[model samples]
Target: MATTEAVKAKTLLGECAAEFAGTFILILFGCGVVAQVVAGGIGDHDSIAWAWGLGVTMGIYVAGRMTGAHLNPAVTIALAAFRGFSWRKVLPYSLAQFLGAFLAALVVRWNYTEALNKFDPGLTRKSQIVFSTLPGNGSTELGVHLWGGFRDQIIGTAILMLLILAITDLRNTAPAANLAPFIVGLVVVGIGMAWGTNAGYAINPARDFGPRLASFLTGYGGAFKDQWGDLYFWVPIVAPILGALLGALLYDLLVGRFLPISDEDEEPGRIPEENTSA
Candidate 1:
């Protein structure tokens, strides 16, 4: 009875709170690592990737029991479209995630204010990279424009959603002993390593937009535009949403639909039945 009551206590508001907390943890570590690299010069690209991956793992562990830790808005939207998640809760969950990320970015900026000021002096558009992503990774040499950034975001987010569905599908070889989050974190690491340079691999819309908005509210008024005077903030937001839906659709068509149902099978991220009362 107590177990059932506890489960029932996870209302929509509670679930949204979990999402907020989980996303906060994710951005706290993810953006912190980036700030260290860009402002403090204490880490490199590999460190950024690893920290972000581990941050995601920790975030899932924090909120999985209550809400499955759909910390990314793209993940929440994808699950709603592909899985049995309630479509009605999508906007609320997304708003929670965005607020979480926004607060987390503010915290990062607060902690790194001295370092950021020292590094950039004037809080220029270059300094905004510490908070949000920049096209071509702020590289003039790459010449990566709007379409390139858009395409990169789509591909990266597609890979994210596809692997997420594959990893969580019970009919597939889902990890045992609650190891799915770790593996998913590793998937993020792989994506970052392979595709981060083009547009910072912001496969999640809230991840980019939240911090970008925070930067805008702060001194970096040019957060919505790139160094080249391009209004580029929409690329990450729109592309990831499209990519997640596309990836989920592909997964269902190619793999999920073909998997056979079994008595022992469970929903994508649910624990086994026997363990529910544990």
Candidate 2:
């Protein structure tokens, strides 16, 4: 019995490792595609968007069984907040996720160092490493961008949370599980195509901060120090958290309460059972 229990523990550890690796690969490829599109000059908007979408779809399908493919911290947080994911596990899961993303960003930097240097040698080290906001003009212009970014992220995350809840509900189990990846990928694609220009569509705080930190470490330039001040830095982090929470709350209000199933359907005696053959 002790041996059997040890084996199970090892298996769980292996699963966690796989989850970390899968998420790292997902971010590397997905965000790598973005870097390539913007810096490599190889593809148009449609192509770049499709690359991100397909990357996400494939990654989720591969990692879903292991770690629930929560490549985004916002998604994980939202799930824990609204769904029943154990609160104890949320911090570890999020930490691993953020680390995976950071590693992925480092890999992206290594892979494209030459290209990045060639395209914009003057680009700050931080800018070269990952994504973040640089001061465009002054407080007024920055405010507009921040507001727009905040609004778009709120709307997009809200919709995504709703979709997640609907698809994951046990009553609609099969379809929900089967198509969740595809639906999520498509939502990402739409967001990238629509709101990417404004805010880079950083719907996930980990996605932004992981790469940003990696950029800071690489020393490509001083983009982080010079451009990404505290005010700008915190907006992406705080806004998304608020947005995701709001979205989940809105979804719960709409579907969980206002449209809850009639008492008759949920009554203990009314549920239909499957027929069996003799």
Candidate 3:
């Protein structure tokens, strides 16, 4: 007979584990590409965008069945607020995602220590870009301030959340043949290409903050603050959460509420099998 503790572990605990693993894979590949671009002198911005998209796809596949792969805190929060996802699970899911991201960033930093040293011996703010986002991409002349960065994150994340809901809603024209994860990945790619310049499009709070915290702990003195001596850590975190809420609200108000109802439609907050991975 299985122990109650064991059964419990296989339920919510297992879901949390899946979330952690999925996010670990996500940041592993996502930050790995950034490390390659910044430290290895290989690949361009487009390559980074593609790799990050692929990472998200793989992460979804990894945890979709177990926990719907809410690899982002913003995603988790949005789903809870709008999609009827269990509010109780939100904090656990977000914590798992953040821990996964943080560990993955630490691994990336460990793996690329040599390259980082060679690229930026002093571990300057330029080097920190590998681990976290920077305003105007650290360009002093670009004049991208905190407010602009916050706005960019909000717009980008709102778009992301809106599309996520659209793509997963069974009543909507979602992709067929279990390809929702791929399509969702492509959405990230599009966002990266279209809106990545300002603050690196850190539309996902965990995606930005986890590695950022890792960078701060790992001796990136400017990780918490930009070169301009301004504390910049809160922009990515707060903006994305608000953006996700806004996006979910917009979707519900403009699209979801208007969708034709049918018995075949999944319950609110319960994603179907095809898009469960997204």
Candidate 4:
């Protein structure tokens, strides 16, 4: 019993460590590119798109072998609901993700402080856009508004989760030879291209909330809310969770219904296997 518990503890530690490292790598490149564009004047929207794509790709490659590389809490919870993941693992995974993201944001902010000072001079919310997301800039009457941005986030994350299921679903044309991670990264690119501008397409709560918290601590003043009368913080968090569940249900209803349900569908410890011993 002692040995078994020790092994379980080790496995849990390793899984959480993988999640931490994966999220750290994700923000390192993803937000780093945003800093470069906003503060260093190096890239454009295409660059941000590719940066995020490659970030997720590398992050997955880092942790895919362990803990299934669920760098997003929404993904974790959605899998728990639809993909038979353990409900017990959700909170720890989310905490690790938030920590990794916050640490990465700290490093990014440190690396770009001078440039940020030059760009905006006060660390206000305008400059904080490098760390968090906001609504559009009014292409029409009085701008797109928070509700529209909320809708965008919901649909955007829904698309993300749906494509994730499609790309990883082996029975339904998933990629060959362990290329699912790369394909998932490409899905992020497509989503960014389509929905990045409106609220920055923050489909992952850790990707935004952690950095936003760091911003608040570093003198941004209520990083979750803005002077524009927008309670924007919960939008990314809640919308992504809902959107992921919606997307998974859509996939299950449309495609997963026809696929063979394997031992993965069994309860956490009730997996069955064929015995062939003499």
Candidate with the greatest TM-score versus the true structure: 3
Better of 1 and 4 by TM-score: 1
Cα TM-score per model: 0.92, 0.78, 0.93, 0.91
RMSD for each of the candidates:
3.7, 6.9, 3.1, 4.3
Local error of candidate 2 at 99, Å?
A: 1.1
In the range 1-278, model 2's lDDT, one tens digit per residue, is: 89866765564465456556656876776668767865788776787667767867876787676666766667767767776554554565667767877888889888988877777676553234234433331233455455665676677666666666655544433253388788778877887687665555667777667777777677644533323343455555666777777877886777655554543332111112221000
Clash number for every model?
Answer: 0, 2, 0, 1
User: In candidate 1, residue 80 scores what lDDT?
Assistant: 73
| Over 4 Å off, model 4 | 137-142, 261-278
| Candidate 2: stretches off by over 4 Å | 1-15, 125-143, 172-177, 223-230, 258-278
Stretches of candidate 3 exceeding 4 Å from the true structure: 1-9, 267-278
Score residue 173 of candidate 3 by CA lDDT: 95
lDDT tens digits by residue: candidate 3, 58-126: 999999877767899998999888777778778878999999999999999999999999999989888
Model 4 steric clash pairs: 138-143
Residues 180-269, model 1: lDDT tens digits: 999999999999999998899989888999999987887887889886889999999999999988898889899989999887665653
Instruction: Give Cα distance to truth, residue 212, candidate 3, Å.
Output: 1.0
RMSD to native, candidate 3: 3.1
Q: lDDT of all predictions, in order shown?
A: 0.86, 0.62, 0.87, 0.81
